[model samples]
Target: MMTTVVWLRRDLRLIDNPALYHAARRGPVIPLYILDEQEDMGGASCWWLHHSLRALQGQFQSFDCPLILRRGDALSILQELIRDSGADALYWNRLYEPRTIQRDREVKTTLQAEGLEVKTFNSSLLNEPWEVQTGQGGPYKVFTPYWRQAGGQITAKQTLPVRDLGSQDRETASDDLRDWALLPAKPDWSGGLAWRWTPGEKGALDRFDRFLEQRLQLYADKRDFPAVGAISGLSPHLHFGEISVRDIWNRLGHFEDVAGVETSVAKFRSELGWREFSSHLLYHFPEIPEKPFRSQFSVFPWQEDEALLTRWQQGRTGYPFVDAGMRELWQTGFMHNRVRMVVASFLTKNLLIPWQKGAEWFRDTLVDADLASNSASWQWVAGCGADAAPYFRIFNPVTQGQKFDPQGKYIRKWVPELRDLDGDEIHTPWKVAKERTGNYPDPVVDLSVSRERALAAYKSIK
Candidate 1:
């Protein structure tokens, strides 16, 4: 039997995994995971990965096959694995990140030159970034036109089932999961993450199912309200490829014709489209992760204050809404999308901090801190990305809190210091009497002053 080595990266799930499925059909499959040192994984991402791999490891073990774990240079390890197992073929799903793309291409070329049938598949995205194009046959800078074409092109690709491994058991030297040190140690800051998330395929499926059963109907109406639990909460799972985008897209097809679901389904799918758009933006413009997509914003005057940035990061921005979002992220490895915008705006505009600094902080803190999505989102909020919000459209943290988090439910949940205040006082604790405002810090920067500063900075670049 021809042994084919399957290199696993972000696509950790067994279902609908193209590379794994095709490799299994060919012959005996040796599943291998390499910890490429070049890849930059955040702390929360590492926490999720640790649990996700543990779950996948159990699934593979059920087939009596070892999910080989090795760390170091991917090319060197693949060459060594090929030699050891006498594998004549290499298979892997494509990753769109800039560094991974270059690395995978080089690996494919080198291995193919050595007479290996190396193949790659698109298991991560519903469509490859290049598949959808404008009429001019160029990439899209705007989302509405992009999703209009891209969404129509989507098909209901059937998810593959877990097939019999056919006695394909291979024993290889594997690195212990604990040795990876993916979880925090001395500080052990992941207590909340452990309580909040279940990082695996089963977890992903369960969340999606719950979203469909309960939240789907109200999703369009209440999705923007931070206090309402109407979100799918599948972002981290999607980022990790614990669930296939195709699978989600396929499942949504069943709800297309259902009454009252059309609007919600469209809204949800557009979110998926946004994920695709972010990837599309990153692939066509690789520098987006590091530099502004809109070049004119390159010279935008941005404040350099670590003290201010740290306050924003630690959820002590003195803006209740922004602080709540930050605190929620720290506690749960996630945040409400509405709050995300408010907090991001407070960072880049209200505080006059650079968007890159906020992006870096999120990339380190968020479980779903994808390179493309994180960078794109920060840029969008900072008015420096393709089709980004206008510079003058600043999010007043107090007004945002009043609008999305009415009654202060979301804020009170995260910002305990402001829990005692009622009415609009919760949104602006500084306005309340000092006795009522506990130890919550004063407004770090006056909102009015910062808004004008941000505008002036944008004018400088313009």
Candidate 2:
């Protein structure tokens, strides 16, 4: 009997999965998931990984397909699987991170060298990061122009349907899921995470459906408010590829009852463009993880304050909004996108810490912490990334809090100390007599003074 091996990676779901669809078309596919111990999947990420894999396993069992798990380097594991299973072909979806790209290239080359048929398909984003470019034929350095070009080329025709796989011979020798230990061993810190998400393809689709029916209509206006459930909390799901961008796109296309359907769809599509831009940036400038994107930023003086970084990470920073964001990130594996920008700004601009330090923290804390988005967004706030915000544009946390979380509900939920405070007073609790406490601490740095210092530092670089 003809046989093919479908290697599951980031694209975990069976529905609308191009790699799985193609593999099923070729022959009876042996579904495989290899846990590569050599790769350092971050701490917070491991929590999400465990849950996502559990969901996938349940889905596979329903279909009578065995998910064979193995531990080793991917190349060696795949080679052995192919040799032993007598699989004629191997298939997987693409990943855009720099290291993943390098690994995939080597794996494909090695597999091809061994006379094995290896195929990859695009199931992650609507467009591959390399497909979009600027007028000069290079990757676009900025987001707006890149997004416009991408939108112009984007069409509904590109989304493919999920292909059904016929029954295949069941294989034994599958490793027990418990042996992987993908979850935390002792003193499980996942209590907070449990309150936040349900990881799976079905959960992802349910979220999308709910958002489309209720929240997406107000997405443009309400997405920034942390207290409101206006934004689609799909980043973790998207990162894990439980749902495809094409699937999301098709769902949006079906909305006919909304008044400004086109505008809403356009805005949401632009957000996906941002995802593409981040990946494109990482592809071109792989060193961005360690070095600044702008050459001048290499000389930009950053303060060495591990204590301050600790305060930021532990959510002890005196700024209520900044602290709220950090705490929210700690409690849940996700943070509101607007709050993310604010906290990042506070770190690089107000605290004078290096963007890399903050990026590393987010990489460790965020369940959806993607290499491209996390690094690019941090660098953007730090004024050292491609198409980054201007160096002089630092966010004033108190004002930002008042503007975004006007009712103080978001701040209250995450920061219990400020829960009883009302309105704008919640943002600057020190001004209130009863609220002020020696225990609570004062603002770490005066906003005006720090902004001036940051501007001067950038000016010196220029």
Candidate 3:
């Protein structure tokens, strides 16, 4: 009997998985997952990884396939598996992160050299990052034109169905999931993550179905509201390839009103486009994870305030909205998209801190923390990325809170100190009488003065 190895990476799901489908077609497939610590697994990322792998294991068992786990460099582990299993072919879906891309390239070269048939499929995004480019043959720096071109190329009719695999499970050596310890041990801080997501293909499909049934119509208007379940909270699922972008695009075809459907679909699709844009930027400019994409940002002075950063991370920044968003992230491993932008701006602009600091924090904390999204978004807020928000457009935390969380319900939920304050008082608790019994902290910085300072620093770079 022919033998094949299906090496799982970011795409952990069984349904609609291209690699697993193709592997089963060729021969009896051995499912494999590698836990490589040398590769950077940020704090919150580790938490998600642990749960995601566990979920994948459950799915594999249902299919009667044993998921073999190994810890080391992927190339070494794969070679060892190949030698032991005597697999004729190896297959996996593509990954877009810089380090992942590099690692895959090296692995493919080495494997092919050893005469093993190696194959990869684009299962992460609707379109490959390199496939879309500007008319000038360069990658797009701005979102609008890139999104337009991407939308024009993608059609609902083109989506591939989830290939079915016959009962062709192969025997393999597997490891205990707990031995990997992808989660924290001593502190066991992942209790928050358990409340946030189901972390598998089943969860992704459920979210998609619910969004189409209930929330897709009002996505454009209600997405900005943190308190409402207006937006599709599928970033982590998308990041892990639990669901495909094509799956989402095809499902949105039911809405008939052209204007409303187009508006909502266009907005939702653009977010997926943003994911592509981030990968494209990272691909063309791999240095962005460490340095600014724009050269001038190197000269832009950034403050070094570990104390303030700690306050921000701990959700003690004294700004209700900022503290609320940070606390939301801490407790749930997720934050609203608008608040993500606001908190990013507060870190880079208000605190005069470097975007790298904020990016690293998000990387360490966010369940959906993606290299492309986290790095690009932070740089965008810092005005140092491609087509970034103007640096002078520093977010006024007070105005932002009053605008988005107008009722202050979101603030009160996360910032318990201000829980007793009424809607009008919760947003600006400093203005409330001290005797009112709300134990809210004062403003961390003078907003008006800090805004001016941020503008001046931005002007110096310009």
Best by lDDT: 1
TM-score, one value per model:
0.98, 0.96, 0.96
Instruction: Give the worst 10-residue stretch by lDDT in candidate 2.
Output: 157-166
- In candidate 1, which residue ranges exceed 4 Å CA deviation? none
Q: Across residues 82-180, which tens digit of lDDT does each residue of candidate 1 receive?
A: 998888999999999888999999999999999999999999887899999999999999999999999888877778987655455456778898899
Global lDDT of each candidate: 0.90, 0.84, 0.84
- Deviation in Å, model 3, residue 364 alpha carbon: 0.9
RMSD of each: 1.0, 1.7, 1.8
Cα lDDT tens digits, model 2, 1-462, are 668888898898988888888888776778888887866677788888888888888887777777788887899889888888888888999887777889899999999999989899988877777888777888889888888888777767555555555466545467777787767768788889887788888889898888888888888787888888888888989998999888787777776446766566768877888888888888888988889999999999999998899999988888889999999998887899999999999999988899999998888889898888888899999999999999999999999999998999998888887777788688987787763433565777888999999988889989
Output the lDDT of residue 45, model 2.
Answer: 88
Q: Judge candidate 2 against the unseen true structure and give its global Cα lDDT, from 0 to 1.
A: 0.84
Candidate 1 weakest ten by summed lDDT: 163-172
At residue 15, what lDDT does model 3 achieve?
Answer: 69
